[model samples]
Target: MRKSKSFSARTLDANALKSFAHPLRLRIYELLDERGPATATGLAALLGENTGATSYHLRELARHGMIEVAAGMGRGKEKYWRVVPGGFTYGDAPPDAEAASALEVLLDDLVRQRGSELARWREGASRAPAEWVEASGFGRRSLRLTVEETAELRDQVLEVLERYRTVADGRQAEAAEEGRDPSTGHVVIHFDVLPLGAVPEDEAAGQEADPAGQEAGPA
Candidate 1:
């Protein structure tokens, strides 16, 4: 299993990857992760989709072990579904050609969605709560490190995030038991680490020519 800050997820095999590569299925999974448990009807309304379609996709997701029935939500004939605790991942590489192509499409869609969310947030950030505006924003850094060092840095960051995740889970449970809203905002955390390829010789020479460094571009 591959472990991230918030959860542990097993890498997906070819069959499971193929099953989960649909756009609607991906959106459904994202909703469950972000909004917590919900019924097919609820999800349908949120997505502007018909209940029948949502129900079918939900079942397919569940069949692939992507989601399951929420424990105590919904009544007879209405079932609530949720993302399975500890999600699944697309492994670094899929051996099957078809699966690899599917993974590419899935990843492209995910990146597009994330870009949209960030763009939306930026457009409305000024009107959001002052505290939220102050606390939320993007961050990035470029570092020179060996492969082992990169792995260590990732593990350390995950450890710190895991601690806060535990606290957040406890607080959520307490709020549920008390039958009161937590008044907590849902926050999304995005983390990524990747190698920047070696600079081209011409670019390297250009950089050396300007010792003062070029201004960074917008993120």
Candidate 2:
């Protein structure tokens, strides 16, 4: 949320995609994004990995510009790393077979991670504060829309999120200058929008026959 002039949006090329596709590297990036700057030793402890491995992956991520040394945060001879401020996307499908495989791995891992996070939240929700428990949950809706309409809806949602991000940044800066509140805590927001139930005919044919003997098609 802390926008800086140094931050720039990135679309991962094949090389960068391959570099970032490793499970450990992806997890390390997530940790940095969620928990702020950390040292290799600290990350290793959390990840149950050796410092050597974490250090190597950290360097790899840095090489791809996914992360950087957190300024003024580490003592001499030690370094802290954090995710770069701007976000990144996978971009178009990679032509290289290896890179394409890496992209699949990355996407699968991300979907699994999201499910795990939601499950964790549900398990702990009962023990959380009453207000938070009341305020937090998931919602889903099936909507009919054209491609352009779907894109417009996605953009509007992103704009709203950006507004909140700016507000959060301002509050964080104020807290840093003054004093932090004990009641403040981190919140993770997830947003996803995509066409549903659109399967290729060949893929659908390969699936088991429906009970009603109907062909599978778009919902």
Q: lDDT tens string, model 2, 10-123?
A: 678899989998889989999987776789999999999999999999999999999998766668989989777546777666899999998887877767777878988989
Report the lDDT tens digits of candidate 1 across residue range 1-219: 234434454577787888888888988988887887789999999999999999999999998888888655667878988766544567676879999888877777767767878888989898999998988979998999988888788788777766776666665555434642656777776666666545577887898799778854223
RMSD for each of the candidates: 6.4, 6.1
- For candidate 1, give the lDDT of residue 74: 68
Question: Scored by Cα lDDT, where does model 1 land?
Answer: 0.76
Best by TM-score: 2
Report, for all candidates in order, the number of backbone clashes: 0, 0
Q: Which ten residues in a row have the lowest lDDT in candidate 1?
A: 1-10
Candidate 2 stretches with Cα past 4 Å from truth are 1-8, 166-183, 201-219
Error of 1 at 211 (Å): 29
Question: Which RMSD does model 1 reach against the true structure?
Answer: 6.4
